[model samples]
Target: MTDLDFYARAVVDGTVMGLGQDSLPEDWEDRLGVNYVDDVRKGLMRRDFGLVEVSFQRVRGIWRCFGVGIQVHRLDRGVEAVVPAPVRAEFGEFGSPVGFAGVDAAVARMGGRLESANDGGSTYHDQFLSASTNARVHVVAQVDDPGVGGTSVGDVWSIHLSWRKNQDS
Candidate 1:
């Protein structure tokens, strides 16, 4: 399977490496198959792991991971350069060549369900709930204006898996 497929399944299974944990695994880089750069600014810790970016915050003197973002499309030239080849290859639709249909099938296969969807003129958004993790899985895609008529959901921009609740500080 492609890296995108692997990571997407991980999100649904609630087994994403180093996710929602107080500390990263000793071999996190090797497990994730990418080197990461850590950024600690504005009291938040962000780790850019090429294909996956994780966000952490300090709680009770411990660094706790709360969210993860996966890169799908080549939105930013700089970030696009770092996205792995496997991920880039799976960049169409809902981060798959088959688009939303493929994502729906995969999610169902993994015991997840689509919670909601929105077509925001130039962008499309899909939210999913993982059965295992109860985490929120969000997908954002660019909407292509064909100019002839109605727009179409284009390539996926990004996917985010977050454990944070709306009321969380």
Candidate 2:
């Protein structure tokens, strides 16, 4: 395997280990598929609860990974409940009586500054950037009550975390 290939594998392996998986997924190789275009490399992996994507580009005469991202989907309800506490601790807690206030407070405590928030008709999206790692974590929630103009953390459908190398670090 090339260096980029190794890096991509490492990302998947690390994610699996970090998330406390017993072993690499049976279809790990298939999930951690790789594709190439020109000189860029894209790696994708899917987990029971989410997906992981990593991208690398040739820079300064060397292959450099640009970003790594984790996207949790809402294909199944109660998915958020299964998120490991240790992982949640990494980003701070969304808190009990989960709601927008808790999520906002969690981001602040995690050193993530609000970057943007938008309403997408049925869903509300909020993006936060962590000062420590320069990574971004976005939360998407179902609009429970438009009249209230707020989203409940319990209504959160998905959460995505992304790490980009030196874009702002």
Candidate 3:
């Protein structure tokens, strides 16, 4: 499958490069060879993999990845400049771009159900519950106007795939 397809499926399946694993290995970052930009001691660590960003939280003294945020459209030129050229090129090579429509379809196909949505003037947000993994899925879109009935319809700005919150975490 194409990398884009893998990512889209990850959103529906609630697993992005092992982000939603029940228990992440202590050397996950080392194994992935991805360096985190933030300090792990802060309890929250962020790793930017160009097209996607993964976050890990320390739970019970173990580092557990909680979420992944994928960037779809490059809206900010200034921010884009900061990303390495090779990293930026990965997006172009990742296959056809997918927006909310594509992701929504994938969600339906994967048996995920929409939980909530919000229209925030220029932006739209949606929350979903993945049937397979029981994870939380979030989609953000950049829209010219609010979608009818609070539906998120626009070029997908970002996708946040995360594990369901645990009570003791």
TM values, all candidates: 0.62, 0.36, 0.58
lDDT of 2 by residue, 1-169 (tens): 2212221222323332232122233323334333212233233223332334434434444443444444333213232453333334344333222343444454455344445445343445565444434444455444556525333444333333333344221
Top candidate on lDDT is 1
**Of 1 and 3, the candidate ranking higher by lDDT:** 1
Give lDDT: candidate 1, residue 111.
66
List per-prediction Cα lDDT, in the order shown. 0.54, 0.37, 0.53
* Candidate numbers, best TM-score first, in rank order: 1, 3, 2
Question: Least accurate stretch of 10 residues (summed lDDT) in model 1?
Answer: 91-100
Ordering by lDDT: 1, 3, 2
Tens digit of lDDT per residue, candidate 1, span 49-140? 77577777766555567677765543334434566443444443223322445665666776666555343433355555555565444454
Q: For residues 1-169, write the lDDT of model 3, one tens digit per residue.
A: 4444545566666765544554464444543445335545456766665555667777886667777666554333333433334333433334323455666675666666545445343334555555555444455543455543333354455666666356344
What would the TM-score be for candidate 2 when compared with the true structure? Answer: 0.36
User: For this target, which candidate reaches the highest TM-score against the unseen true structure?
Assistant: 1
Give the distance in Å from residue 121's predicted Cα in candidate 2 to where it truly belongs.
12
Q: Residue 81 error for model 2, in Å?
A: 7.7
